[model samples]
Target: MSTVPIASSRSQWLPAYLALVVATSVATGVASWMFLPRPELGPLLLLCLMGILSFQIREPDVGLRISFSFLSIILLASAAIVGAFGAWLVGSVSMLIDRRQRRWTATMFNAAMSGFVGAAGAMVYAMLGGVEGSGTVGLSTVALARDLGWPLFAADVVACLLNAALLSGVIHFDQGIPFGVQVRRVLSGSGVAFVGYGIIGLLFVILWYPAGLGAFSALLVLAPLLAARWAFIQYGEELRSHERTIDTLVTALGTKEPAAVDRSRRAAVLAEWIAEELGLTPGQIGTVRYAATLHEIGHLGVATRLLRRSPASLSPTERRVIDGHCVVGARMIEGIDFLEDARSGIRHQHERFDGTGRPDGRAGQDIPIAARIVAVTTAIDDVIREPGAAPVVSIAEVARRLRGDPGRFDPDVVAAAVIALDKHGWPAGSPAPVAS
Candidate 1:
């Protein structure tokens, strides 16, 4: 098939995400004000939720970018906590310990130092502003526990959740997860989990509460919280698995299609096609999808001069760098567990049917099957992305290019590639496949 030129890329954003965060924060705060306490703190709760945006700050931690994601849950969950403890000060401390001090003890000492200082500061500010009542938590804090019959502890719990969200928002993190993905997975799974757990808790309340499971009623109520964590972890893994695959697909175009320059877009489309032709089971497909995207990430190490210039004009050093892309890519994904599946494929993509490939030079069946499949698709993608050169051609034509012998590709993998492209209505002619 003919290659499609890469489109001008659009910058991704978080508008919908911002709307969601604001909506949730306001909703939680409003509920707290209406049903519980602290109507004055609702607006403050909204401001604290805004802190979710802080994770986007670009900073390199060692070589890995900080994710800043796990704690977003901590923040959203903590909104009530901060609101209840509104007048209390917050703190932070970092210190180096002497030789005899245990590491954990030193860490706790620092945390305590920071926590106490922060608490003192908050109290001092409140005192200066003349917050007179010992029982009052904030300006509009509900005196419901006193005025009505609600337990103070329950009111404090709601306040604690709010406080956690606010503090989580403000606390700067060096690294974590993408807030968007985190939100998606958290929302997707937690929505389902909350409902499920709610039903279970309802049954427990209906059946057990009357039967005097009173000693454990509070513990039974904690089910939904536990469900939230379980749901988050499970769904987060699913989200991350796909994320790794998309990264893999991008890696492929970046490396093998270096000369084509339209690689990112082209490889993405081909990856979609290959995913179908390979007849991957849904779970396996997810892994394959991510692996294909990152199959050429090592190519990033190749010098721009060498990538663009004629091979004849390349210097020895540049050639070495160009050849070393696979190794680089493998190293890049070494830390990501789901991505480990794609590493062998990326590393071996350049390997030939005969054993002339660089790095390890494993030949034929010795090479991982995934690597072979990636190699064939990569070749086809490059041809399609070729600028001004039949960028509108058909899949049959591209398949022919791939089929020509001379140790070009593993023959079975080539067949698999051709079938995949054709069945998916692939190439520059068909609608391009989308990457995550």
Candidate 2:
């Protein structure tokens, strides 16, 4: 749970508006290419310019955004003569803004900031884009596009996507936990720039000066993007405001409810090794890590004492009720749009590959891939988390424990489990790593 504020630094709105400018340029470029005749290179050049601006927009605090705004105006005004230099100049301007100190993982920040400069550069490129590809408007777009090839294009697209992603990531990371943001807002807002450009190009069919119309259209897109930014801000704030309520709800469910589950610092440290052993991609690694923290969320519905009870002490009804948690947890998450992607893991995490598992009794291929991964991980975590285990146990002994009956778990899952145990120094009878 988070408590995003309603009035959090209204200044963030400035950056959001700048971001919109670049977004509109992208929207118009694509539109013009699709609807306009033969598609003169003007709008495309602007798109490229926006690409750089989108990356380079972040500058040294308050002073720079205003400064860049003016520079962008001059760059656009002088576009006919300066051409690509003007475009690159705007990108360089953003890059030049000093942030006082470099962050440990500043690469994405740098790339995204560069895009901001590119956004302004798009405006500069607007005049040149209108010069008509063959003559005065310029060949910078063609030359840059050819020179950079797919690598640059890929970078551009990634920059756009990452700019949105990184912004949300920064907010979440700074807030000190995992929480959801409205992904649709970021995507739609970023998309508007290109859309506005397209509409303007459409009007140019009868208007003649398509490039000029395209610039004005970019302004049109800016309006909506700004509103969207406000919405994003509001959404973030509302999330913050509701943090306490969500936390209380989690407490109502269980001592450590899955919905509000927070990873122990130690668990986070150990998770990295697990991720490496599994050869998980960055994205996959995040999923597994989050799954580990929320693995017990379904237990919210289970009787508290039942969780504490030994296997022998439980009544048949109590035990059955405990096993039904996966369904309960999954259903609870299904109601949330953001968590839908992880519902499969939350539900079938306790299931085995063979048809012997509880709840849905999904077998083998019927099981979701993430659920299978979680099942192995859940068992491994349990093993290490137990106290008074032997330290020098053989990997084969551990393998045998999990492999007691292949039908009880997926063969492949068991195999992966064995490797994970071995990777984490879990020799025969050794104690598993306990959650912090």
Candidate 3:
């Protein structure tokens, strides 16, 4: 099994990404010259402005980011209804004028890639038996829908794939992250938005055929367009708010037990490595990371006196008070809809494999897999961080303890952790494994 370091880091792959951008730009430019339509200054300028106003929407929780621009919808529709050349002109101009990309190289690349995407989509539409120009005027709604819908959908798919391929390639090279993971994140994050925009583009095609890009015709779409943009804005705000709340909680816990918080973060990194090694889905890995970070959140509710006292001298009641933090943390986050999966792990991180530990005593595979992973990772992190309590325990020592401790942790999880630890070049000596 291979392990990935969970720390966020980047490598220098700018030259490579820039080269790709240049290649794509030049290739698309040549293709555009061969097939793209002559410039239509009026609609082209409007589309460019719309593209400029469009922003990139990002949701880190789902590891997704996408550019949300009405210009794209309008341009795609114009491509299907008017011709590919108009879309090429508008998309190319918009990319060049995009002020957000400060670097000339990036700006040029964006323009080139977008122009290519638009051109490719137009070609696809034309190849799919789509009517050109005013020919779309006489078709019945059903005929238009059938003729236009599939081609538009296919074009949309091409646009998405091209965009994703270009961006994901850069990310993969620069960050050394998996390409599939980056692609999945990008698509999942914007899947609904992209589909909605595509549908809107189709609507634009239908209206433009009959109405001729007049004020009244454009006005017809304003309500729905505005509604869609507003919905996206609201959704972005909600995600940001949710993220802020998580940060606040983590900060609060850090204030209460700085070491514990640090330990939690380290555990999260290790757990991510183990989860990936175990072939968990990206979504599941995200949940594991969150759970690991908040695994010790229950410690925040423990009394200062209890924290200060040595564990060896703690009374039974004191131990119980300490042990109940999992339940407390779980309860605290149970109401949070986004943290639902995390809450389960937080609650069961203390549970043992042999029906002997925690609030619920489930044995072996009955325990939540996430909780089991967290337990193993947290235990290992605790040992690694412990100071002067014991001589630096070796990875072998850690594995030995896990193997020796009968049902304290899941063996499979423990095995994964050991492999990850070894693969990450975990220090030779660390503290003995701490009790969960």
Q: Tell me the TM-score of each prediction against the true structure.
A: 0.43, 0.50, 0.79
What candidate 1 gets wrong by more than 4 Å, as runs, is 1-222, 225-230, 237-262, 281-284, 315-320, 427-436
- TM-score, prediction 3: 0.79
Ranking by TM-score: 3, 2, 1
Provide the lDDT at 410 for model 1. Answer: 83
Q: Give the number of colliding residue pairs in candidate 3.
A: 3
| Model 2, span 44-119: residue lDDT tens | 4454454344323322221101111122222232222233333333444433343432532232233234434333
**Runs with alpha carbons beyond 4 Å of true place in candidate 3:** 1-14, 35-41, 55-67, 81-89, 100-113, 214-216, 268-286, 313-317, 353-356, 363-365, 389-436
Q: Looking at candidate 2, what is the lDDT of residue 256?
A: 44
Q: What is the lDDT of residue 251 in candidate 1?
A: 47
TM-score quality measure for candidate 2: 0.50
lDDT of 1 by residue, 307-350 (tens): 77766687898778877887887887788776777678778878
Model 2 lDDT-worst window of ten = 61-70
Task: Please count the clashing residue pairs in each candidate, in the order shown.
Answer: 52, 41, 3
CA lDDT, every model vs. true structure:
0.43, 0.44, 0.68
Which of 2 and 3 is ahead in TM-score?
3
